[model samples]
Every structure is written in structure tokens, then in C-alpha cells.
Target: MIGARVRQFRTARGLTMSELADRAGVAKSYLSAIERDLQTNPSIQFIEKIANVLDVDINALLKDEAATNSSDETAALDEEWQKLIAEAMESGVSKEEFKDFLEYNKWKLKQK
Candidate 1:
């Protein structure tokens, strides 16, 4: 999951693996391994290097879904949707309101 999150954030930032590896000062092969889940455990220093280049906190890189709040759940969104979600967050749209909107949309679709 950490591997997936790293890849997601890296891709969302429009970075290629080579680019990220170079920027993070880690080996491209190692980064690729991490992304592919071939390497399940990485050192803290390694994570810090990648996270710094990715512009996310170390905690964000390590957090499990159950530990996540509503905003943290947006990390998996595609780039366009991420932008929309960010905009909504910045506009102060509460999580409860978003949940209500989603439920309403589902109901509306069913009615149709």
C-alpha cells in the first residue's frame, strides 16, 4: 500500500520514475522495486528522501486507510479529481456535506 501511495503521488505530480529517483537521490532500480512492491520494507531515510521529493509528509506515506481522515482519502483520486477535491477543501466544504452530496447523487441516479 505504501508502494502504491508512493507511485500514486509521484504519478499525480507528473513525475516519471526516473525523474523521481533522480530528484530523490535514490537509485532508479530501487525506486522501481519499491513501486512494484518487490521491496516491501524501505528504510526511514529512504522514505524521507522520496517523501521530500514527493512533497508529502512521512506520515502521509505511512498512514493506513483506517487512520485516514476524509482529506487523506483523496490521495487516490486522479489528477483532475484531485484538483477538484483540493478546491472543495480550500472552499471549506465539510466532509459531512460531501458525503451528503454523494448520497443524494446516488439516490437521484436510482430515481432515474
Candidate 2:
């Protein structure tokens, strides 16, 4: 289950197993074992490393597939939104700054 999620995020990010293993600093054999479900109980530190390399939250890698799929479907971003977010990230706009902008806009709307 966790392995599948790791593979899903990894592939979605266009990273091969070897790339992921190399970036995460884990052995390729060990990563392969995890993805194959041959190693079911990876340590928290290992998971953290993989999640960091994958650019995903740890829970995204740990959640059950069914639950994750349902939530992801409901939370899916449109392409424009995705592009905007990517642009914002590339421009170095911190999440806190974005949140502050949103709050300011909300307050402005209330005033109007």
C-alpha cells in the first residue's frame, strides 16, 4: 500500500526508481524491496527521506489508496491552477505570504 503510493508519486514526478533511490540516499535494492512489498515495515526515517525526495507529505505516502484516491479526486486542481501554483513556487512566493494575501483579500471583500 505505502509502496504503491510511493511509486505513484515517484512516477507522477517522472522519477525512475534509480533516480528516487539515488536522491533519497537509499539503496536501490532496499527501495525495490519496499516497492515490491517485500519489505513492509520501513523505518520512519526512511519514509521521511523518500517523502522529502518525492516532494509529498508523509501522510500522502502512508494513506490507504482508496481514501487517498477519493480525497485526491475531490481536491484535484485544474491545469490553470496547477500552473499558477507552479509559477508562484518558482517565483519564491512562500506559502505564508500567499495565505496572508488570501486573508487580506477576504478582509477587503468584507469591507466592500
Candidate 3:
């Protein structure tokens, strides 16, 4: 699933196998194998190379959907965040205000 997600993100970026290989400094054939799931267990270094090439977080490459939040939970969070953002926009909050809100939220979470 992680392999599939990485390939999806990579393709969405319009990167060919060889193009990504060049950007990641990895071999094209190994990258192909990784995409095809022929090699189920790629090393962390290899995964990091691919993630960097994709301009994505390494956590994105390593995510296990089964162990993470369910689609329903994520959807709920998305809906809530969207509502908050809409409200913020309607309130004419500046970008700086939004940045401050995000920072405050991060601090609040850390305290938790």
C-alpha cells in the first residue's frame, strides 16, 4: 500500500521512473521494482531517497493505513477543519492570524 501511494504521488508529479531515479540518485531498475512491489521491503535509506525525490515526507512513504486513523475519522477531521477555515475567512482573519492560530494549536497539543 505504501509502495502504491508513493507511485501514485510520484506519477501525479509527472515524474517518469528514470526522472525520479535521477533526482533521487537511485537506480531506475530498483525504483521500478519498488513501484511494482516486486521488492516488498526496501531499506529506510532507499525509502528516504524516493520520498525526497517525490518532495514528500518520509512518513508518507512509511504510513500504514490500517494502523492509522480510519477514513471516517479523517473525514470528520477534514470537515471540521474546513468549517473552521471557512469561518476564519468569513471573519477576515489575516494570514498572520492563521499562522498564529496554527502555532497556538501546536503549543496546545504539546501541552496535552
Q: Write the per-residue lDDT of candidate 3 for residues 5-36, one digit (tens) a residue.
A: 66766765666788889999998898888889
lDDT of 2 by residue, 1-112 (tens): 8887787667666678999999999999999999999998999999999999877789877886456455555444432454566467658999999999999999999999
The C-alpha RMSD in Å for every predicted model, in order, reads 8.9, 4.3, 8.5
In model 3, which regions exceed 4 Å deviation? 65-112
Total clashing pairs for each candidate: 0, 0, 0
Give each model's whole-structure lDDT: 0.82, 0.80, 0.76
Model 1, 15-65: lDDT tens digits are: 799999999999999999998999989999999999998778998778765
Looking at candidate 2, the ten consecutive residues that score lowest on lDDT are 74-83
Ranking by lDDT: 1, 2, 3
As for candidate 1, its clashing pairs are none
Greater TM-score among 1 and 3 belongs to: 1
Best by lDDT: 1
**Overall local distance difference test of candidate 1:** 0.82
